[model samples]
Target: MRVLVAGATGVVGRALLPLLTSVGHEVTALSRTPRQGTVVADALDRSALHRAVREAAPDAVVHLLTAIPAEVNPRRLARDFALTNRLRTEGTRNLYEAARDAGATKVVAQGLAYAYDPEGEGPATEDAPLWRRPPRQFAPVLAALRELEERTTDAGGTVLRLGHLYGPGSSYAADGSFVRQVRAGKVPLVGGGGSVFSFTHAHDAATAVVAALDKPHTGPLNIVDDTPVPLRDWLPELARMLDAPAPKAAPAVLARMAVGGWGVAFMSKLRGADNARARLSLDWRPRYPVWREGFAAELNGTSDGTQG
Candidate 1:
């Protein structure tokens, strides 16, 4: 397969390139800035993206474009995700059209698994409705996600709705911003930490993209691990792994004052995702099936953290 990966330098994208090659696929990286083997073109730039896609002449195109910041403030969540929202909305449209024009047979794009409405009982399935009345800052983010998924699936493509990504180069990394906050006792467990989280290692996420390329599955597939843990469970465990002070508990009302409504919802109301459909459809399984083992390996330096 001749594959072109947009946002090739990103955390998951970096992990994906080498995996695709190991499985005997010709990979072309598309980036905004010039890299040795990458075709330079901003995803938001429609004309440039079309020209780049045409030049690559890929059989498949993977849309992993994002502009996420390293240190995200929950108070400014929407502002932080503004560019990423555009990538998911406008960028997806450009990529879909470009892929069609370039004669690509497959299109695989990234999505979020934790965007489901918080009123559910168990882990959210692929069909669960997105947050109907999200926090003011988060509403636009969900709108963009809906747009991305609809556009990709309407084009007969696959959307990998990944979970809270944790590994090298991700927010949960040892040196990452989230970890830094945890270490400084800045992140608190809010309202008994009831929100459940489903995690996906960057490497596992990359492999799922490879599987999507080889499989016949389309539409959204939750690419998460076997275990779904509540914030109270994972936060303390992550603190132990980092040798940091355990996160302190805070009332939801007070937390809202500090981290904003989005932060409180993130720590108290978010739902985890189920990966069963992805497992069956793509015949895929996560190497680190739970966050405990994955976090240990990543922080202990047993797992390779280098970007391609």
Candidate 2:
């Protein structure tokens, strides 16, 4: 299969390029700054993107761009949410249109698993309701996700809702970002820290994307690990792995004030997701099912130090 991957240098995209190649697929990586053979195109700029896709004439097109790096900064994080919202909405629209014009048969793109409502089921399935807290503020993001999924489904494409990403190139750094901040006693565990959250190693995420391409699954599939831990457990576990002091508990009132409503809620509520669909449909299983087994490896700059 000939595949055109936009944002091919991104976290997942970087890892995905190799997987697609390893399987004997001819891959064309698209980037804004074209490499030797990359097609220069911006997701926001429809004309350039259309031209690139038309030129590549790939059988499949993957949308993988997101405004990252701001995944930690408070202000920038909000901006990233808005920016990525556009990427999911406008970027997806552009890619789908371009892919259609290019005669691509399949389209696969990234979505989020943590967006599901954290209160309902013990482990929510793909059909669960999305997060509705601060409903007005997150309206655009939810709408965009819906639009992206709807379009993808309509085009016979697949949507993979990935969990909170960790490991290399993720915002949670080996020596900086959330991991470091918690280690240095800068971040306090919010609201007794009992929220259930899921995570995925970047490499696992990449592999899942590749698997979905080969499979015929459609609709949203959760690309998360089997283990979903509470903030209370994962935080201290991460601290221990990094040889840092455990986190101190912060008052829920204070935490809500500090990190805003959504942050506090996410840290203190349950948001687990089920991965049975992906596992069954795409023959995908996470290499690192839990953080304890792989946290140290990620800090050491490898995905479990056993990728073959």
Q: What is the C-alpha lDDT of each candidate?
A: 0.91, 0.79
Per-model TM against the reference: 0.98, 0.94
Best by TM-score: 1
Clashes of 1: 0
Q: lDDT of candidate 2?
A: 0.79
> Can you write out model 1's per-residue Cα lDDT over 13-43, one digit (the tens) per residue?
9889999998899999998888777887888
Q: lDDT score, residue 28, model 2?
A: 94
* After superposition, candidate 1 runs with Cα above 4 Å error: 305-308
TM accuracy, model 1:
0.98
Give the clash count for each candidate.
0, 0
Model 2 Cα lDDT, one tens digit per residue, 1-308: 99999878776887788788888889998888858768888888999989988999999988887776534544234554787788888988998999999999999988888888766858789989887663344556667788888888988988888888876666675754777676787777888887888888778888888898888887889999998888898888777777788789898788766666656766787588889988999999988888666676777765532254
Q: Per-residue lDDT for 184 in model 1?
A: 90
* Top-lDDT structure, candidate number: 1
